[model samples]
Target chain A: MHRSYYTLIASLPHLPLHFELDRTPITRPRLNERLKLLEDADRDVIDQMSAFLVWDRQPLDRNDQEVIERYDNLMRTVSNPLVRALINTRINMRTIVSAVRRRKAGGSPPVGVGQWVDHIRRNWEHPEFRLAGRYAWIRPFQNLIDEGAAREAQRLLFSVNYRTWSRMAEHYAFSFEGLILYLARWEIIDRWTSQDANAGQQRFEKLISETLGEHANLY
Target chain B: MDESLLMILGWTGIYGATALGAVGSIIGCSRAGQAACGAMLDVESGYGRLVGLSALPSSQIIYGIVVTMTLRGNPLTAQSAPGLFAVGVLCGIALLFSAAFQGACCASAIHASKNKPEVFGLSAAPAAIVEGFAVFAFIFALVVAGGIPQ
Candidate 1:
């Protein structure tokens, strides 16, 4: 047994075990890929959270039904409605004029973002794109002023909403409030980048840029 | 203070201080432009009730120059009124330089404000305080020059 052990040890090469790929076929995407998904989800989260944060649930009018249907379809296709809505909204963020230009230039607009927004009325629908709409409506996270009595209530609601929504995702579980914390991070990052002009946002901006590839100039 | 000397002090200080302030105004203008870009980004979602976020500093430089020039000089001194003159020069120059520097600082504050747009109002307080010092200096110079025995 000792000789056998000695023979085994002697037979072993003076190299790392990792170098000898035992052909372990670990099937799946990588951690970075997962992270990228998370990052994309995060952008979606930001978009949906923003809609909730800054929009009112005024129902879509008669002319706006088509847009709403598309939005609903997009939202339903993804596992999480809020995340899906957020992602779709963010992905489609084009300036109103540019959106107009694109629409006119393209001749017949496709089933993408522009078609949905154009038909919506301001009273029933909330449009995030600034140059396209007359009014900008954002549903601030809390109904009551933070200075008033319901500060804790607001905080609790924020968390619960985020946690619940996040849990719906296959990998990450997030609630509404968790969504807020993520939003807060986004806001802080936005503020930091804005103020610290020298400190370039290679990571966050690059992620956003990639996410926005063709529509980079939308905002 | 002698009358001729008073004239020399008043005009010279007024000219020098105003000129220095004018130089500061130009520098401040450039800085304000940089600050404005960040401001534009921030104002994307926020309320911008106040109109002069970028142009405000340029106005300050103008105010400094005007304040310096408008000061009353001692009537009696044909000669250099050393006390009256020194006060005018020091105060004029002080206000001018300080205002200019404050303009640059204001631009920076505006830039800083882009991130935390909610606290843009906070920047005004510090800038106001600094402006107060310049105003104090200017007012003092005016008072001293006016009090000089012609």
Candidate 2:
């Protein structure tokens, strides 16, 4: 039996079954414990997350750019096509949201931001990024951004992302790579929600219900 | 057909069916065993489900054995020997594939359930369906065996 793939996957650890992020600040010890479970292929994503913990707010400072670069590096290293496509959908959503935010501010985005977003925007229709486009909420999100609904667009982006991850978790339940990728995305969302527990709870509750539909028993 | 030839064929049918069943079991068990070992590394509890699912493919061989035994009861004769050989080999082939495919299904179930224990019962449904085909072959062979006289 060719089980090396499964063995590699089984060696990785998973998040607790009853994971909740509302009102609970992520302690360094807790974060580190989670980090220890990931393999080397996911190290850059971990580093980016650690950076984001420090630089949570918007406007993209030098350190935040470093975090983006780390995320880009992590994206490049992912071997699974579906996981890679999911990550691309996230990057596209973020870039579009950031561009909308910058446009509304009536100033140029932080140096290098416009160029990167433009590159991703141009290439999204390419064959390589075709699968990513399938799950992307770009068209409707772009309409929201165009209508000056930046806050709504941001919330909708997260909602769309939650749905994508939920779909992946269901379809790829048997795949180790798919499970790890979905969990990583979920943890990042959890950590983000922890920063503002009240609004996060309301936001995620709506999104979770929408994503899970009648199976929304994940209270 | 020669009387000696008929006797030899009757014996061949008996042994061949049993041997085929053993072959299917060996393949199925090894495949399921690999998945079980992988699942063991993933969780601290609920190992019973994984081990139990792994053993499910072994039933195909048992079905093969039953068919073989049913065919072995009749006396050697040209008319009876050929019918026994046909039923025994075809039934063994069916059981063989069923067991092997069921093993693959069980491996997938074990892999998934190890990660998310909630899906354990649901994941076993596909493997059980595969076993149904083996049961069909086992029953049909037994019924056909009854028609071949001593």
* Candidate 1, B1-150: lDDT as tens digits: 565665676576556556655665565555555445435533554425222554554554555565455544434245435654566467656765666656555664564455456777886666667777776776666566565555
Question: For candidate 2, lDDT tens digit of each residue in B1-150?
Answer: 787887777777766677777778777766776677666865788878788888898887778778777887777677788888788888888878888778778877887787778998998899999888888888988998999866
Model 1's CAPRI class is: incorrect
Residue-level lDDT of model 2, residues A13-62, one tens digit each, is 44333334453333445445544645665555445544433443444433
Highest lDDT scorer: 2
Candidate 1, residue B54: how far the Cα is off, in Å: 2.8
Off by over 4 Å in 2: A1-80, A107-158, A176-190, A193-219, B1-50, B69-90, B104-126, B145-150
After superposition, which runs of candidate 1 have C-alpha atoms over 4 Å from their true positions? A1-219, B1-10, B38-51, B59-73
Clashing pairs in 2: none
- Model 2 residue B110 CA deviation (Å) reads 5.7
Residue A30 error, candidate 2, Å? 12
Model 1 DockQ vs. reference: 0.00
> Which 10 consecutive residues of model 1 chain B have the lowest summed lDDT?
B42-51
